[model samples]
Target: EESGSDSSQKQQSSQKSDSKGGSKGEGESENHEYISDAKKVMIEPIEAAQLDINHVVFLDPGKISITCPKDIGEHRSFIYDLETRQVVKLPDNTTVLKKLDNDDLFVMTKENTEYAILDGSSYTVKKAIMRPANVDNSLDISPDGKSIAYVTDEGLFVSDLDFQNPTRIVAAKREGKVFDMELPRFPKWFDANRIGYKVVGFKGVLYCGVVTRDGTVSKTYMEAQDATLYPLVNGDYLFRNDSGKGIGIIDANTGQKKFITESLLDKEGFAFDKNGKWVSYYMTNKEVTEENKWTGRFEVKGISSESKIMEFETEKPNAKPVENAVASPDGKFLLFTDMDMTGRRVLYKLEINAEQSQQSQKK
Candidate 1:
């Protein structure tokens, strides 16, 4: 079982946890944008429960990573062991970023200026990196977790595992960015060779841009409206619109756009199952007529293949939307969340695969 840590303790600890049809090239494809609201298909989840945290990520089958809210008085992030029901606290004011292969996590300080690697096997700060002041709070680790990338006033920088031997491969002037507040969040590596970042058109519209490691930038395809970039596959990308928090995708080459869920009240309600079989996301049920009640449902679909849509219930009639959805490692289960009248986060479970759904139905 993994255990909690104090500011003084140092060691390792435990626990860790796209679709195709993008364009192929350099010429812009006439600003083709596809917007389709998620088709509503509400099904009762296999199980439902609630949690009291700001947000959470499923770490593995038996564990979860959770960040507590300031009002909750915990003011820290930790790993929650489900079967054992134990909690291991991480450093205060630190956000657990990505879980690394060596049982470590890439962490960003709450200040958003510093980054570090925390040992996963124990309670210890393995390394710390204070980035330049202009560095954006959002970052991404390479798929292998052996490298890190962040943006600063000087454009994009890449470094070994934890900010070691840094080099700026692409240089951007202030005028090229979407905002001057230095708050452009979450730069992603499409693969090892290419990196994707958010940019702005002359009209202040958002565009998801891609650049190769050799300093070659691609013709922008994500130029439809103002949307932030999320990775879907190698060339196609997922995007959350700048307004209304609608979820969509843009072609890495042609810039074509498609909406999965038109809008999500919460930022993290959308997630994918293990093995890339299905995507689960939350969206407001605008069709709901009741006032002062919860008005959202989750939708699921296959990425490379098609599957029956999966959804959760709005049984409680509370006002808050479902906040997040986390998939199990085996791709059989989806753990999702919402809120209660007291403002606590509620968790629910659904079986997506046929075998799991059958067993859950039997039980």
Candidate 2:
């Protein structure tokens, strides 16, 4: 909870390149506020959590909902209010489909079989959304929250929030485009009128496709031999960054690649700020062997200018490496997921210096 210099586990170094990324001088941190301290959130006390937290959705700046995978102690989701330090179960024992920030409406699901739209403020069921019987991670609500898009055994369909008037958008029988329940890249609503999906073809090839409300796929992004496409919030994507080596943003609309950093090794923890201005990922120079595979240098860089904002290496002896990172909504703090020796995932919040964060917020 204390945010100050924790030099013991945080490494701030001089001008050098560890791998192919993060070229910063030793004095670089004097101008920028790097990581300070980290403390585990008090969520472990809740026994149902089973010492694991994942799939976090920000209900607002003050509240968040988290859910662990099915393999956890019990399949359930809980909402944690940061200000009050209270946890409550979500209605329908559902998983949040989208972040409910200020917006009063969002979709959540129960065991992937049923869907419901709820009012964020009251947490009351607003509409009965539909889900494909056999699908997981199959539904995405439109940006406007008026429509829901989902994938089924037959095809992809769009319907009103009430689960009625479903219009088939893509037919698997005719287009050979099917949504894979096993993959994390579920159906996504990229804009007000379109849903994005990825089609895995023969030999592990991928096609990043965007279908408009009228079901048109033109000039889709066909992937290179081994590249996996990750969708960006704006329908652009992490086209070249999937390999954990070259990190970048590819404009699927124009096919322009914006290289953020090259030679990063931690694909497990790649993230962009809410505005897509800053990027964070892990990098390493030494060979990843059994002994030191879980330690490396983490960096945050400006996307367009390719400038290094800050870098630090985390130290966790005999524990797992940081697997995920999220920038706070105000661009002032970073939230990370680390682990203790017992393999319990812990959430840590690190804040930048007040001056640096205040300036960022003004931007």
Candidate 3:
């Protein structure tokens, strides 16, 4: 009886071990499947040796316009045809500002005092208008191409395409109780009848709001202490906080604000995809040394907090850090200006591909 009991005990122990091993194997298989599904996409770099392009604007899927600086302190803008890989120069001394929704180009003189609407195909000036006095280069043409919105010392103004019958959308003021002084900057068109702008108030408080073409300001949509307010095609606004903590979006109709992230570092560059689904921002990794000193690695995170799609390490020796990284309208490419290891400023285009669709969760 003792010998039979020993055999049974040994068999039971063996069976338990086999069961545990099978469970472990299944766990590892699940882990491998998850990792493979969540793998990041790669970024492919494109080199441009023939053209000295600085700024780029996508005219369409197959064509892009670039602004190259001339030796005379003016810009020579041109259209680059991707299929043919050819660069065709536009008008000289003209800096392309905003590409209107109608596919026309809004261009300004290097002096910023003269503005014109140019035909994209012919590269000819369709309408020329003299900018107002004391007005800076901050301007936005309406979507329909019939009006222009700009900022002046007196206030934010909108005028007809011909510069006739200019109307003040908002007036600058000085208030001792709330703010010492308040002025508008960088007026943009929200729609056909509304304009958006950033208001700099006392103590460097920034506010963003939308006002009607007839000067009716929306009280519910004003955001204070915001850095920059970008009008989106979906009628929403994307803004960064004054502390630069993170970026968020404000719904145009609902007036609800949702933050995307809060781990942003000061002066770190960020850009949103055209559809506002994905954001690419710079992040730094710090290392502590034996001497109690800290070192940082400049990296780029092409994701939000909840999901990560791709990451880039820009910590190479002698490679200047990137700035002003922007996503293409189609969200397929990222463009940025950076200095190479040779210390020459160059524009780079990065192709973005992800395994899964990038969709942001609305909280």
Top lDDT model? 3
Would you estimate the TM-scores of all the predictions? Answer: 0.65, 0.69, 0.72
Error (Å) of candidate 2 at residue 55 is 2.9
* Residue-wise C-alpha lDDT for candidate 1, range 26-135, written one tens digit per residue: 21111111111111111112111223555566666767776655543435677766556566777776667667656677777645667777777884788777765666
Instruction: Give candidate 1's TM-score.
Output: 0.65
Number of clashing pairs per prediction, in order: 18, 5, 0
Best by TM-score: 3
lDDT of 2 at 343: 62
lDDT of 3 by residue, 1-363 (tens): 114533343233332233234432211111111111111111112233332446666677657766666566866677766546566778888877667778888887656678888986787999887876666678888877888787777888888875578898788875566556788877877667777777877667456777887786554355536566666666677767655456677777777777765545444446666555566654432332333221122222333333444433322344334555666777776666554434444555554554432321110
**What's the residue-level lDDT of 189 in candidate 3?**
76
> What clash pairs does model 3 have?
none
Cα distance off (Å), candidate 2, residue 176: 10
Ranking by TM-score: 3, 2, 1
